[model samples]
Target: MPETILQIPVAKIIPHTLEKHGHVRTDNYYWLNQRENPEVIDYLNRENDYYQQSTAHTKEFQKDLFEEMKARIKEDDESVPYFYNGYYYITRFEKGKDYPIHSRKKGSLEAKEEILFDCNEMAKGHTYFNLSGLSISEDNTMAAFGIDTVSRRQYTIQVKNLVSGEILAVKLENTTGGSTWASDNKTLFYSRKDEVTLRADKIYKHKIGTAADKDTLVYFEKDETFDVSVYKSKSKRYLIINSSSTLTTEYQTVLSATPDAKFKVFQKRTRGLEYSMSHFGDHFYIVTNKDKATNFKLMKTPEEATSKENWVDVIAHRDDVLLEDIDIFKDYLVVTERFNGLNHIRIMPWSGKGEYYLPFDSETYMAYTTTNLDFDTEILRYGYQSLATPASVIDFNMKTKEKNVLKEQEVLGGKFDKNNYKEERIWATAKDGTKVPISMVYRKENTKNGNNPLLLYAYGSYGVTMDCHFSSVRLSLLDRGFIYAIAHIRGGEDLGREWYENGKLLKKKNTFTDFIDCSQFVIDEKYTSTEHLYAEGGSAGGLLMGAIINMAPNLYKGVVAQVPFVDVVTTMLDETIPLTTGEYDEWGNPNVKKYYNYMLSYSPYDNVVAQAYPNLYISTGLHDSQVQYWEPAKWVAKLRILKTNNNQLYLDTNMDAGHGGASGRFEAIKEIAKEYSFLLDLEGIKK
Candidate 1:
């Protein structure tokens, strides 16, 4: 390791006092929240300079790691073509390009290719670019797409005349980067975000050739806690506007053929009722938690009478099974469920035939229905993958019980082999006697020794399950004697909805303790010891990284937190921040005394103490809309002043990206290389 002495960047502190629930606290690094302040930019730049200087010796090694990982990825990769509308759409990448080219073939794959958008050409001259919500018109002559150049997720919607290959003149600003076209191709509906909070609170209708300012406001979600979006139902009959919060949802619908018709509420919002609608033959299939169905259930209501009272159970709630989602087709209704912490795809014939689950051989794997757009077809498209196996896109015949693998992710390196790797699922007992699951993978040659370095990762919030899936980049760690594990902690719906319920709001500490328990279990089982264990997570999972280190800093040797939401109380209290208001149900509204007290107790920034801590690598994006850059910036600034140990602490801020980091495919690989290099360097692995 290089012993070059470097000056650490110390942010200027101007103490700011905040009082909430009659409690006062002083924050010295609060000024870092000033996104537009010159001093804030100076501090971030200095921090970046320090990072560059501190890791200067690893530059060549980082490059090697980047190339090694890049080699594993097939440069000219393409996604499985799914038949939708009148065309078969495909997204493919050229051999050396950083972006994808969207193209389509009419009627069949053998037809002449019609280039929709070559993103490589579109992304030119921009540091960051994202093309989202590509909605094709009913007539198949036009396409509406959203473009975000600044990376804050505020997209600009524009239309393209596919027939003439020319971008239309009108542009819609401040949208959520998606639009839904009415049956009349000339009319489109989209969701717009609030300029300050970045909340999708308004739905608007626009005519193709008109100015964006003249677009009519179809609906405005007055409740600050709710966000709205517009989309066309799969049946292509209705245009639906969905308004949702963390715990509640309401939808409005109108016939797509009548573009100017007013939308009628399908169901009124209730505080604890969460539901989603899918249009079918004569009714709308709903996946909901109404009537206290904690794990959710499948229900349906006639299209003419759309309300809670008219809803009838299609599939009753089961205590042990979580109804995650459903896909409707002309002859079969496919349901995606989670049972015993594994994905199960259930197929039921609409003609009253018996239903059965698709067989899966892996003990821990991710399987879900992919794109099944053609309703008349008997074949159902789905995806399957595990820690050791590459992802395979499969087409299953719902009637014949036959399946065909269309494409499998190719690991380009010659050294790769699925047979050489091992995957396992283990259980850990939490502090509350609750059992948590951990999915792990490593090279078969690796032994369960305390000396082996293990990287434990998780994201335990938003009822989002972190499934065990394949990753070519992960082979680098496994081959280097690293055991990669994901802790299915309480905040996720890994086990069921109850798992998520127990880890959120006032019970949020369960998430932190669940992770700590998993860490201890791995060590106790000789998978890895404290000195050889490390942690990693991003976004809400980044919050997990922050909390775990604060709660059990001595359990691991180091931690990597990407775009961490460390300043919990401060962020939750400020409604102007993106995602704050909508997440009140997840993290209790801190305005109340009880919630404020509980949040302050475990808030990472508030709980930073004068004690020894683990070596840390933190990352953030300057334009991150989900978790503002200031949260991590303020955290690092505070940690520097109060931490009692001289451990390695580094912060890398992506100057030209947002929460997901670099927009280019290869550029994203470079970020991963940097992270892996940090881990390998700590273990004294040079190559």
Candidate 2:
């Protein structure tokens, strides 16, 4: 495949006038750069004159621009096909379909037709389930799958009898997601959730074949905000029950499950470890800060805390960050930390004390926050990353203590010049003197200066890290003479807990400031100028992109917002929505004055006032169960009606799609086409 390289022109890239508008910190003003460029002043003066003369004509320009890009991509056959009918999927595309499971035609479900995994036949090829994830049993007699194409957000747990290839039991709709198969195939221990608050989940137990058909409510709480996470530890017999809930604004309740335990009264007023004799086990591991909620530590249970105590520091917490994940293997616990803007997976001693951080090859790692891991393989094989390096499958082995690459996605037939692309890791100081890291990837061959089209991306939310990996879609941009960069600022798990703490809650403005720092770096380093700059993000990232554009709309030529949560304050306060309760740990609960005011500070949707917006492309899916499509849809609609200046707000939505645009290869190809068409046209790439 031929890689796209940028052609830069150093001399005139950063017009002197551009450097004058430095970053100004204040919540009251967004898009602080409204000054006109002198060198591009003629271009700007004419653009402004046109905006004043015909306020409504530019909408037609949007159509013309998109068509132009579609034509250019047609000229260059290397671009991946982005379909519309269905978004892309994590497919079972291997070997010939003559085999049972593989035989199910690809895209069969696009028509809402039945797509089955020939359990009986496919299981024989060592391709059990012709799928992934946990199975019903080691014998492969029965199969359990997390079905998503059928539903959005909610996953239907289906158990099939491999011998008959029949679905024996199906839990049609469930908020209780992430189903795990218990040792006893007939008995499945799944976590059930009660959507009382958007902040947390309550769990239940389900029996597979019994008349007690309904999932039995087990460990539940009256608090509107509490999180319940369960694990079928390596012991294979004990189920580790972990629950965390914010008490007031800062305090919390952390509880663990014990086997066959009964609750007893305690004499000590507080700080005594609570336990039940027959329900929760004697051993318990929890994510707690007991000392500080912001920074967390993994703790073990005290055998007798009330008895003048045997309370010991099972895992003394780190002051730098919180424990993002906890995975257990043969008494060895794996704790993933968000530190130094990097996701480091650390192995722990049984006592949960000493930590040996595993060295990872990828610049960014999955916090292991979410994703199903293969317990038997001891291999960390699932997660997404796109940074200085190309996107790849990072498979780490626990047994051999080795790491290997599983796959690298690339354009099937295109020729790529990777050496022409160079990735630089640099830091830009925010107004608060907070140094933020930015990752840039561009074709080194195009040192012709600022002529290169640049794409700046970021998603600063929930303390999540923007990892380094590859993206075939990048080839669509890179192969077309464009450069790309990612902003690792505050509010993301990039540098760990301290990074997040600096940008979240009351300090949320740090996110916007850090993003601005990234854009400034691009100009200062002479990588690309305001003329060729474009910015993008989605969902939370959408909010980020939106904020950046508003903060400095004149600096960017085009903006992309995919299902952005710009309406943060409104959505967070609306209890009617989903996972709003489970989200408090990430975004502070806005109902209370402290967090309410915090959310209102930088909410892009609510803060939309009279301003010069950018040439914007807004995308959303009708079925996006996570961030409601209407949020972005309404934001675009209002921006169209509200912005006094003549700017493009191209609204796009897939009526049949969910958060994921479309499904399957064909549909995804169309989507890729649509996105690239719009982007290329905006950048003036010739067809």
Candidate 3:
């Protein structure tokens, strides 16, 4: 056999890499002083100003294109008739509320003419946006809803009186997560986070009537240095809290409890891979992989949900796909699973049954659903389609076997045929002989034109897949003779575990190589010329852009790295930074010399050898608690210094914005427009 390669620990290699510092891959210390790269920094500063100005001057866009873009984001009504106590309610979009619609229910779905929360109205009566995680009091007199900014930063909790179309309360802000009320509706419980401690995500529960700080401290997570999210289970009496591992390859912990008490571990899965728990009558259904490392199974437990020892396996995944979505109600269990590259939704027939063989309906993209007793009334299982079928709001009648499209977004009204925009799935081989799949959409009229400009996008880290999703953004590009492509390379969940396993930690180079391969595939096939191509990725995808810029400079003409994690070694090594410690699992602990070396090798900052790079723009937000702006700010500075090519390198750190800039919808669209404008300038596209 060829020599078995024994990889040295990153701890061992980092000292050497640092020893060779300032040399830009040459391993020399002369490069330590960042000031030596002033010229490069200055050039990049100019590029940064370019993006900031273009975005600032968004009024330059053609009136027709601007108007057309605005017309595409329309939402249909899924009016639900909720009648409780002495109140009647109809929930519909509040028109004229700014860029995106804000919603509230005035009467039930059967109400004569829908009374919407007026968009022209301001303050509490008119919310920032639609109510997510809506919970009406069991009595229906009080409606508790949540409104979030486009980026989900300014999460505000609101309570409305059903009959008056009036706002009762706008309780909190700066809240990232949300919660709801108990059956009595007198008391409400929700979680809060203080970004002060970067390590552990501390959660707090606030009772609606009490002072904010006086909210009950129901649970103080033992692991303060990790991520945590809690949800109310189907029983309504119990809650499920999930805590992820911080510094190791540990499986997430699932805890159970009621609103007033501490949570107890329902299951302590070792190699969890992925898991979810749902409650029915006497048994609790949990999908886990305690039995197999990569596989999952649906198990039923009669013992108290919190007792891990009592949990036993009932059914597990026999194939590659796991039990993705499941619900336990009244007498039945509804589940969604994957099979043969497709998703299946099914309703199992048993007190507690599962092969996880399939799901109840494969056609709908169900984020979640609630069912009534006997599992007869499937309350809400919403979904939408991309490319062909625009978004639709559906209410499935489990008992009658009938489905109602509560709201189907109206697509282009006969101007552009539905069939005109088609999705093409293609696969191309990478430099490492790996096959990377790509999804694209383009106008049918120009199907024969391979020379059209292209916008290639990807987010190939953290097991994130460039999964198919409907987007008005893609439509905008495709309509403009621009082909939009998603590069589902390794490091994402596109093909499950194996895809990610091959591209992270010591093998991190695969992320960049895979992206480069995608660029080459499109170019070699003449789908688009390298000069006309553009790449964009955010956060971990930002790391992707940084790597691509260094590894394959000539591949693309322009690039947009938003909130990029480009300074790999520095960011991962610096535990003082907010998101650094939590990322050790995805990116090996940089303090370890082994990981240090591995990271430094691919770190765009450390590897910025004197060379030409594409026209690049790097962006970050001052308040991005996750990926701090300094990492990109520093990398772009270093890149400008080390780069030998005269191409432009832009740096934009939005002082007013957090990780996602601009809270308003119009501002958000302007941000997109600015990036597109920069790309057009770089590609010389006349618009």
Highest TM-score against the true fold, candidate: 1
Q: Write the per-residue lDDT of candidate 2 for residues 175-283, one digit (tens) a residue.
A: 4445544455555544544433333354555556654357666555554555555555443444445454432221112222332233232222233232211112455
- Give the candidate order by descending TM-score: 1, 3, 2
TM-score of candidate 2 on Cα atoms, chains taken together: 0.70
Candidate 1 residue lDDT tens string, 1-687: 887578999988899999987799999999898889999999999999998888887899989988998998999899999988889999999888999999999999999999999999999999998999999999999999999998999999999999999998999999998998998889999999999999999999999878988999999999999999999888999999999999999999999999898899999999999999999989999999988999999999998998999999999999999999999999999999998999999999998878899999987799989888788889999999999999999999998989999999999978998999889999999988998989999888888779899999999999999999999988889999999999999999999999999999999999999999999999999999999899999998988988988889999898999999889999999988988989899999999989999999999999988888898999999999999999999999989998899888898999889999999998998998888888888899889
The better-scoring model by lDDT among 2 and 3 is 3
**CA lDDT for candidate 1:** 0.93
Q: Model 3 segments beyond 4 Å from truth?
A: 1-48, 52-59, 62-64, 75-96, 99-107, 112-175, 198-200, 246-262, 268-274, 303-309, 339-341, 351-380, 397-403, 412-414, 447-450
lDDT of candidates 1 onward, in order: 0.93, 0.56, 0.61
* Pairwise TM-score winner, candidates 2 and 3: 3
The 10-residue segment with the lowest total lDDT in model 3: 7-16
Q: Which is the better candidate, 1 or 3, if ranked by TM-score? A: 1
Clashes of 2: 79
For candidate 2, the per-residue lDDT at 168 reads 65
Worst 10 residues of 2 by lDDT: 11-20
- Candidate 1 has a TM-score of 0.99
Cα deviation of 74, candidate 1, in Å? 0.8
Regions of model 1 farther than 4 Å from truth: 1-4
